[model samples]
Target: MSEEDVVQYLQNTPGFFERNPALLEELTIPHPVHGGAISLLERQVSLLRKSTAEYRGEFERLVSIARENEAIMKKSRRLILKCLSGDSLDDFAGVVEEVMREDFAVNYMSMVLFTEQPLDTSVRMASWESAEPIIKEMLAQSGCYCGVLSVAESEFLFQSQSDSVMSSAIMPLVSFEGGQVVYHGVLALGSNRLNHFDKEKGSLFLDYLSDLLSALLLRLLP
Candidate 1:
């Protein structure tokens, strides 16, 4: 029979290999490497070994992610406790900036709240008229924006450090009251590393950070 006929027959008869077990050992195929003939059984063993290695690599990646998340949880707890312990609202922004810069290794950080009434705090207070357009364009509909920033956006948020920033994670701080969403402000972290804040990275951590800030601001604001 032809080679195609042989292949078809082998496919049709699942028990053919079991019936003639010696064929599996005798059947020789070109080796993937070394350019030599090897038995079908040897080829099967090689494929299984490759698959096992791949599975092991995937398992290690998952374990690394779990460990990273655990570390983040610990740091977040410390931040919460320290903030709550502080006596005045004035220290909130300073605490956040210090922790994020010292522990998290962020290159730059800034917070801006859109309020007509000036507040005595480190956080920048501005009118909604100017910040509205920038906030809308930067964040769009997403709660967090992680990637490179436009020139205007970079200057608006980072100012003097704008030229040094390569990537950023920007979060819109919002509060829900009586089923309506209130856009309070923006929290941003910039890094010199090009891939520090990637677009593909998960934003769940940023979302939690924004929620914490919003809740605290709601309590501290008049």
Candidate 2:
């Protein structure tokens, strides 16, 4: 009989193995690892071992992610508290950069405010008319963007540190004025690692930060 016929027969007659139980121990299969033969029982054990190892690895990975998210939430809470306690926009800007560097290990960061009026803050200020078109395009596409940025885009956001940044995340700070949406500013974060802010990565945390910054800016704006 053909191999298919034999397989069909074995599947159809499950009691065949029980009737001739010796085959469970005597039948040999090719070893997956070393070049040798193993009994059917040994092959089954090997497969079970592999499956168990995979499940264990997946469990550990999930635990690691949970711990990482917990730490991030704690850091985010601290950042919010600091912002709330700030007396001025400059203080807010300084604390944000400090926390990003000290707590998040960010390589480079930029906070840009869109306004024509002179501001005392250390963060860059530009008129909405002079804002880069790419920034507008990015805001149009989504509230947050995470991925590798072009050299020109990096320069506009990161300035002198542009060359060092391999990947970045951008969040637009938006506010409402006279019932109309206003794109007030942007927060850009850069990392040296190529995949630190990969396109596929989730941006929920960044979006939360953006919302906080937008509220702060709206309150502090002159």
Candidate 3:
């Protein structure tokens, strides 16, 4: 057969190497890194080594992620305990902000709650009966929204200190009574670092913290 025909036949054939065991070891290929040729057996070994290394790298990445998640969850448990141990809503808010700054390395943290009537707040808070469109839009997001925010949004949340914030997260807070949302709040966290509150970061931990805070606040609120 012609060279083309032979090549085509091999492409269509399965187990051609197994059928021609002698040829498998008899051939040679140019080494990728070295300038010299190597035996077919050595070439196969090299390819296998490369593939094995790739798989090992992937396995290591997965292990690292698992370890990181485990550590976060452990810290989260402690945070939850500290939060729940508070004697009153004000105490709980203090613990929440303190823990967030110390454990999460946050630059700024504030809580904004909407209410029909004014209520005493524990931490830095803004109470509004009717919010601006920008504020309402953020609350309507339903959950955590993170990234570089607009000048208006930053100013609305952070006010005069807005200039220092490079990244921010706004977590919508809701109180459900009889499966209906009754009250809404916004938990805002900011950082000077541009990458601190990135959209790419997972929000599972944030959601957990917000859920705990919302539930606690709801119990104390009307």
Clashing pairs in 3: none
- Indicate the worst ten consecutive residues by lDDT in candidate 2: 134-143
What is each predicted model's overall lDDT from 0 to 1? 0.85, 0.87, 0.78
Predicted candidate 1 versus true structure: per-residue lDDT over 1-222, tens digit per residue: 899999999899999999999989989999998989999999999999999999999999999999999999888887887777775567777788888998788999988888888777767877878887766777675678899998889989888999999999998878878997778788889999999999788788988988887777677777
Find the candidate with the highest TM-score and give its number.
1
Q: Distance from true position, residue 209, model 2, in Å?
A: 2.4
Instruction: Give the runs in model 1 whose Cα sits over 4 Å from its true position.
Output: 1-13
Candidate 3, residues 27-100: lDDT per residue as tens digits? 88888997698889998898999999999999999999999889877877877788778766577668868878
Poorly placed runs, candidate 2 (over 4 Å): 1-9, 12-22, 176-180
> What is the RMSD of candidate 3?
2.8
Q: Residue 204: error of model 2 in Å?
A: 3.2
> Which should have the higher lDDT, number 2 or number 3?
2
- Flag clash pairs in model 1: none
What's the CA error at residue 157 for candidate 2, in Å?
2.4
